[model samples]
Target: MRSYLFVPGDRPERFGKALAAGADVVILDLEDAVAAPNKAQARDNVRRAVDDGAQVMLRINGAGSQDFIDDLALLHGLPLRGVMLPKAESVGPLGELAEVTDAPVIPLIESALGLWEVMTVARGPGVERLAFGSIDFQVDLGCDGSDEALLHARSRIVLASRVAGLQAPVDGVSVALDDEAVIAAESRRSRALGFAGKLCIHPRQVAVVNAAFSPTREELEWAARVVAACERSAGAAVSVDGAMVDLPVLLRAQNLLAMAG
Candidate 1:
């Protein structure tokens, strides 16, 4: 999945619109997006949508919150695509959540404690992927939102996800809704750092995020050439554009081609 778009659960009118927004996954948000007084109503709306055959992922409240239990209760026996656990700080709570539903869990690492324990969380049972909550992470660490400031944290998430054998982590949202250039640059940077997807706040960001994560035409051609050369060489070392094509390089080219498809 290249783009995961968020739609407020309380806004039932927007649910179908979100599903039609061309995102790979639509996350019906029940956590931060819903107010306290409307939490129950939002849960009911999401349940009804699922019963109506709308496929979507749910973003539940944090583990320690009272709403967490109620959120799980709403999901009982429903056919959900997945669940996103906000402010995920440990594997214990994640394991407890797994016991409630068979859907794969996606832990959003936002706090310092959560970032430190990310490896354990990624390796936890039924974890489908990891997602970075960059805005919350900056708040927790009291740092700026510049790439330099978040590089360490971002790198750590990528390393943990790779080490745990999960899909590459999803980068956090780019808040500048009007600037497609910023969104594209950040998406490219995230992809370069081994992130397979990004969290999109608006439907407008989806196309740019998907394009950034996908292999370019030049990249696809290069990959195809390298793959053909490697196949002809029969595992022997070959040179592609003055660079020696070995096992790792050949595998990378093949992976690029597969991603393109």
Candidate 2:
């Protein structure tokens, strides 16, 4: 899933529109996007949407909050793609959550402490992937939201996910709704850093993100040439476009083709 779009849980009227927004995954946000008094109504809306069989993920409240328990109760028997736990910093809560539902989990790393404990969180029970909550992480670290400022955090999450044998971590949302250029640039940066997907706050950001994460036509052509050269050489050392084709390069080419599929 290259683009995971978030729709405010309280705004059920927009759910269908969000589903049709071309995102690979749609997340119903019950945490940050929802206000305090509207949480209950949002939960009901999410339940109705899920019961109606929308293939979506759900972002519940923090594990330490009372809303988390209520959210779990609301999800007791429904089928969902997964649950995203915001401010996830421990494994015990996720383990308990697994006992309640069989759904996979995606832990959102949003704080300095969460960043420090990321490896453990990635290895937690039922963890399918990790996601960086870059906005909140910046606030926690008292840093600017520039890529240079958040580079270490993003790299750490990617490394932790790999070490835990989980999918590459998802990058946080880009807040500039009017700037598709900036969104594409940031998504390209995330992909270069080994992020498999990006989070989208608006439907307008989806196409840019999906395109950024996918291999371009030029890349596919290069990969195909590399693969063909490797096959002709029958695993022997060969040169492709002036560079030596070795095991690592061949493997990368193969992986690129697999991702293209």
Best by lDDT: 2
**Would you list the C-alpha lDDT of every candidate in the order shown?**
0.92, 0.94
lDDT of 1 by residue, 136-245 (tens): 99999999999999999899999999999998899999998989999999999999998999999998999999999999999989999999998899977799899898
**What is the C-alpha lDDT profile of model 2 across 100-184, one tens digit per residue?**
8889899999999999999999999999999999999999999999989999999999999999999888999899897999999
lDDT of 2 at 198: 97
Lowest lDDT sum, 10 consecutive residues, model 2, at: 92-101
Model 1, position 84, has a per-residue lDDT of 95
lDDT of 1 at 130: 98
Give per-residue lDDT, candidate 2, residue 164: 95
